[model samples]
Target: MIPIGMIDALPFGNSRRVRNANKFTELKASIAIRGVIQSVLLRPAADRFEIIAGYGRWLACLELGLTEIPALIKPLSDEEALEHQMEENLNREDLNIIDECKAVQQLSAFYNGDRQAIADRLAWTMKKVNERIEILKCCDEVLEAVTNGTITVGHAMILAPFSTKLQQGTLSKILTEKWTVSYLRERASKGQQNLALAKFDTAACNTCPHNSAAQSGLFGLEDQKAACSQPNCFKEKTASWLEIRKAELTEQYGTVLLIQQIDESDRNTVDSLVVGEEQFSVGCQACEKRVVLIDDRLGRALGSTYENQCIDNLCFSKCVSALTSPTPIIENEELLVAALENELGNTTPTISTETAPLKAKKAKTEVSCVVPKKVIETNKAMLRQTSVDLLMPQECFQLAMTYAALKRLTSNYKSINKELSNPNRFEDTFKAALRLNVSDLKAEIQNITLHLASIESDQTINITNMMIDNITFAADAKAVAVAKWIPTKEILSEYTIGSLSALCIKAGVDKAMDSKKEGGFSTASSAGKGKFVDAILAAEFDWSGFAPDEYIALIK
Candidate 1:
């Protein structure tokens, strides 16, 4: 037995936060009448003992003016004592959900954010631990509702992801209108912002009440774990940032193309801008169709400016289609001026009579296609605010695939397929898109642009192939050297046996083929060139390492 004064009570224990006043009162009465029926568990703490369990029994004995009480005293580490307290509290039937969550939170903090340790010590599932920790993000008022039995733990979980103001507002509706858990969930889903795709800087979001990370006090969220509670603020910031970026680029270059979101049905808009694979050139930056595809979602998510690619799919086909047979295909005023300035150092070159007809033809084409400024501004405004609703489940799946493909095409980042497949990733990817309103069962998709040149060209397979080619055949000589461009039977069919043999020799495959049989090259040659071609194709070697000679160019 230990003296009652030697034992210290928990500062925030179940006994202090009464869930059932009558039950606690009866316990105290029972203790007074029958003495302490159960011994309280305690841990030695220097000069005194700390209650590890049975807080109510200890409190009742202390109130009854008992000088000594039965106790099982043991020496335990801080972590062990916390585990004991949480285990005892969690098993109680009358423990308030709020207090239960707080106990779990304290245990979590005691282990320094090692949730698995808490789970293991308490023999709780990781999912249960995670849910309890998430509930701890709920504001004091929302938690109070859970304690008061006005809302369930499920309602608090849904409300935990939103701001305190939003939580309070939604709580009033839930109380006045008697909303179900599913309805509250639906409302919360509509207002979330996926921080992964945000265009603007999010350093301030760390402390903002509207961010889930701030609400939970979580830091360094690299994935879609963090979300914005205020969708309107996120939308306005993205829109404003994109506009400012566009303006800055426009000032640097005469005209810059902006690529945002476009509907899959309106494929012609991006199709008109990007027609073919236009090679990059120093003078191409001066062209009106130079693209600046703004992928605010990925740019902000990955913390990379390279996510905003400068697509150089110049309007090559568009320009060629505008020219007549008499006009030289290379007769663009910008190109001509650029070339003259490069060769003659600021000398203004006069237009020869021979070029007059070409200039006149170009002028006619420009005048014929002139759109009014008001019409252009209206179109721009409409494009800026575009939203798409994907109704079918198949459509949603297809969009997810497209999003994965875009990530591959536009950046060096890889392995996003599994990430996008997760349900939470899918929700944030679709729900928090710019101008996208995913309400209830419906999803509004936006913020996708395939081409910066023309909205009509987004659906063009040619542009997609061009992008693939551009990455596959990179600008760096070393990258092209190691590119995995192995020749298939179809590609080999284009090359003659002589060319194939030459490439095989360069790759050291000929030596292996010749050594396989006596007089192998002679025998294969005598049988016909097909034998040699077969030998080259069947050779077990790294074909990607081989590059054909310049003399064996494709028969274009």
Candidate 2:
């Protein structure tokens, strides 16, 4: 078996489907532990292989670090290869709904040319299929929901009966209100019936009694003529006049009533209120005279008509009261101060006198109580002098291994805590980090870890596992395992390398220890030196060498 590094990726095949399936970390782990048992199907190419059936297996093997993966290279025509590729993907359970719908449509066309039969084959009724098609006709609002995986086919089906405009409006409202599918369905049903009924009622009201009253002219001279000529004309005239009278009374009694054209400006204020030949009239219920208050605008009679009626009596009383009322005046600050001093003169005052020394002591106590606290000094010297030493090779190795193990544990934790975190798997992130093989950048790693901790605390899901997995994959596991034994933040804050090395040996990784011919101290020193050198060499490379010039230039 060749080393896994020698194998190249398969060419001329669908990469998207392969990548999606490989997102299953369990599958990747299985391939990692067990050698690839089955071979992938491929079509023979000039120099490369065209993957047909086992794309997932091929990706898994690559991830597992297998140098030469087992592949069954077949010499098939283009048409045959295409058929095999399609069949393989068709069998996958993770096929998206859009693809499934398109497949049904295509297959239906290929078979009996009847779409309904195709829908039947899929266990979906003709109506259901039609609804799905209608969802496709929906505007961006509904389509965006489908694409974003926010709304399901069932939800879209429920909305199918609505016209595009209505669907868009409803969809917007649903999103804004954060409504569930059930709520949306209920609202749609009720809204449709209510909207239809409202339209009908509004159309009917356009010709109803209240609306037609203004157009019927019963309050005008035509109504007066009708009243004099017809037998029931007086009743009709009274009804119309009463309706108009009630409206005017309602307006007059309403809170914060707007008295039409009552100018409050100094010059026009009283002039605008003056009543002239233009008479202001309102029908009164007390004595229906269609009361015309004339002369001044203050509801006063112009002539001596209906002098004994209740309307005339009430108007005269109101006008006389308003004319005789006193004008109001506002007081200034000097007058207010004089009034306050006069009020204070009627009250008694009390006084307490303290002896000289006691009074001085009381004043001092008050001053002290009112004063603010003094500022405390900070240990800025110690803070400025702080420096973190780079981790030795073994320490780095141990950390990487611990990160990998933690990554594996995080995956298990995520499965149990599905709703608690984001769906991005930590294992994948760890694997990527491991691929980088970082060991010498201990300070950077520590900073990153601290930043990540802050992010993990705020985020729904823990990405710590993915980060650890990536670091472990990039670095040597043996060295990482040794580093894991070192003291954590609390212990490291006080202890130096000499104190920590004993702890490392106790935790294991003493296997790589140097000869102790001179002494244990000498051996430990040698080991530390070797590990540090290894870490430095690993981190010194120019990573730009591996990237394309275009990418490097873009970064620059």
Best by lDDT: 1
lDDT of 2 at 28: 80
Per-residue alpha-carbon lDDT of candidate 1 for residues 1-556, written as tens digits (9 for 90 to 100): 9998898864333322445778878998998889887788998877998898888888778778889889998787654665677777788887776666666655543443457877897788999878877776566788888888998889998876455566788888889999999998777667777786676898888778777765453475444467887866886787688777755543333233222221111112222233221222211222223323333332333222221122211233344355433244445676666556657865654554345433433233321111222323332232222211112233443454455334333322223233333323322333222122223113211222332133221222432222222221213423343343455665554433333443455567757767886666555534544555676677666666554433111101
The candidate 1 region of ten consecutive residues with least summed lDDT is 258-267
- Alpha carbon deviation, residue 219, candidate 2 (Å): 20
Q: What's the TM for model 1?
A: 0.36
Candidate 1 structure lDDT: 0.52
lDDT of 2 by residue, 523-547 (tens): 4434543343332223323322132
Q: lDDT of all predictions, in order shown?
A: 0.52, 0.38
Provide the lDDT at 373 for model 1.
29
Residue 41 of model 2 has an lDDT of: 73
Model 2 CA lDDT for position 279: 16
